[model samples]
Target: MSKPRKPKGRPISGWLILDKPLDFGSTEAVSKIKWLFKAQKAGHAGTLDPLASGMLPIALGDATKTVPYVMDGRKIYEFTVAWGEERSTDDLEGVVIRSSTERPTEEAIRALLPKYTGVISQVPPQFSAIKIDGERAYDLAREGETLEIPAREVEVFRLSLIGCTPHLAHFEIECGKGTYVRSLARDMGRDLGCFGHIASLRRTFVAPFGEEDMVSLADLVALERVGDEGERLAALDDYLIETGEALSGLPHIAISDDQAQRLKMGNPIILRGRDAPLATPEAYATARGKLVAIGEVAEGEFRPKRVFANH
Candidate 1:
């Protein structure tokens, strides 16, 4: 039998800030966008639950190397909690296990908001992606196994009550990595004595990239359907943000071609007389405005940590 040919896409480098749609898995979204761009390699900064929607940073080619930095960036999420109901998944997607008629007053919720702020411990939802004995926690929960999800410390920069009603309340949260909006909602409901679950969730942004940079799949598909192949590709390129944008908060350093060449070969360059931006010991080095490497500076020497293959 003839060997089945492998499908290979072109090597495109950049970041695509996708405004993810509800009910679409992160993996599926990445696959669709990857196909549209015909990118050889692709990845996402973090996984957004299929039930949640908002900014999902899709990294293409060399941009994938910066996913770790993006994942560590602060995140903003605006969500709604429907009071008086508890669900197995802690979101609307699962079966409801309990309900109550009690609802927290606007004053009561506002008062409780302060308690959720700062560093706090939260137990991630059982129907989550956390691994348990080499298997996913959700897989175990789906198979009727009860799992004890430990409470871990997560930083909540700000938690504010944005709006409220008799049955539901809206909130906006700024949190560090690993915080779960569902857990916050569930805990809030419990504190109010009615029990609650996340009825709706939308991430406003994931640092560096904001709502202003987001593009929808429908819009991307429309661009792909227009004009000739080259024109379509050009249209797509217009939406792709440079990979260096992911390193926005990091320090920037301009290095000479010789330094860049040495960095590419995983060598450290001494910056004795060179003026390096010392905002942070860690910085992104560029040569002629193109990202060359991410490195650290110590004792006037720039050390290549991760070199980009964009050139």
Candidate 2:
């Protein structure tokens, strides 16, 4: 008789925040990480332009399942605006095609930033990842085709001016998902009666992950070098944050061994053990106090909307 096939090893599952380096697209960064971790399933939560860098969350293994839940969390960035130049990509990496004639004082620029805070409509740059008629807008831009990228409704929760000079301004941003900091810098220049693009950008936070948690390109390259020289890379477990760490900020309930087994059967559970039944579906912690899934109260029954973990 033929020998039975052995099951493949389970993938390492958890969220990892990388300090993205300049010139690397979000997809490229995720690809490198996928190679490094050898995780069968992996994904990134948001897109970052190659010209920008900072807090980028990469979901490895089954952790990719939780990406949607974490995506809506707040984000923070520190970006710079150059006073008199504009480019095709809305950042310095793109060829400069326009220059502004007007110059505004630092204080003048600071006063104008508030008008952009809160809910607003923004037209994305022509050279962007936004899709149009089943084709990438940037691809069309490269084809020398003109596209009227529509204004999108995005929110900027906070915009704080950190420093300023005659030709450049530094600022911090705490904004909702899809708030394009590069686009914001471009528009800010226009608001100042000048044209501008992002010269430097760094992301500091994505809800549960922060700057302190980010692994840098230099660090990853160092690991690669060590492995190339026949040294071991990090331990298999070092990269993992326990599944619960992903939802540490949210409220939770503890399930006993028996209840955990029952949850796997897809049966509805009573709210008697939970902190409170969610009025609307939202991610909630598990009976073991781990973030398990999104739960909702419907017809006096609690049902799981998304289950992020099985262990």
Candidate 3:
């Protein structure tokens, strides 16, 4: 018997703030959502480990262009650190390399928060996706190769001790790009002399989105399973946020349809006359409230860098 052909997804667009469940990798979640929506193109704003869960912003079609903005935005996470074991991977998934009976007092843990907040150097865990010599650091570590991953600066906006016990400490942290929670746990452990590792992690939100914006995969799957193709697509649309919403962080300039056409055609629009607002370094140009393009505004000219396909 011949194998059946795989169904090709439709030309769908916009974003899905998926409430990724624990144990589902970011890539797998993106694939599932893409299939559910039958999208033509898909990508995610950030990578979330299988061990972590919560708001994973998946971008479909033109929405992918705005992924960089969301990725660069701050992230908030609530995680638990089991304070007696140190692991090779810096999380529960790895082998325990050391055990400790030491546990810091609540006051002690809180005192260390200031030390980690703001710009601080962090050495990523050996078992991580970071590339070294074109090979994944985790792959190298699994092969028993020792790696000296250099410490780099990362920003932690806020770090708070939420709750704690003799063996477990819970924390909520808001951080900027390149900040690794696993590394934070490892260093916090060393600083406390308790040798802890991440036990559980849940990303509450990524900037431009929050927990309120998230929809669980099971909810989308339930909608898809119960209806015909037409109805399924309609139901899915209820959750698909508009692509323009992702660019909300940037200042928007409403241009004339003619200006939008010129911008789309890769021609600079002269921002002269009374209607033109003062130029910003960069801005999103919209025509009748629809995103036309993203561009640099210099000396009264809108120079298109990334143009969006008008729907």
* TM-score of model 3 vs. true structure: 0.94
User: What does candidate 1's lDDT look like per residue over 1-311, in tens digits?
Assistant: 99997658877899999999999999999999998998998999988999899999999989999999999999999999999999999999989988998878999999898889999999999998888889999999999999998899999999988898999999999999999899999898889999999999999889888899999988998886686988898899899998888998888888889889999999988775546554356788888877899989876777888999875
Alpha-carbon RMSD, each predicted model: 2.6, 3.3, 3.6
* Model 1, position 132: C-alpha lDDT score: 83
Most accurate candidate by TM-score: 1
Error of 1 at 178 (Å): 0.3
Per-residue alpha-carbon lDDT of model 3 for 8-114, expressed as tens digits?
A: 67766788999999899999998998888888789999898999989999998888998999999999999999998889999989999988888899999999999
Task: Assess each prediction's global lDDT (C-alpha) against the native.
Answer: 0.90, 0.76, 0.89
Candidate 3 residue pairs in clash (backbone atoms < 3 Å): none
- Please list the residue runs of candidate 1 whose C-alpha ends up more than 4 Å from where it truly belongs after superposition: 1-7, 272-274, 277-281
On lDDT, who's better, 2 or 3? 3
Error of 2 at 145 (Å): 1.3
TM-score of every prediction relative to native: 0.94, 0.88, 0.94
**Clash total of candidate 1:** 0
Best by lDDT: 1
Following a full C-alpha superposition, what root-mean-square deviation does model 1 have from the true structure?
2.6
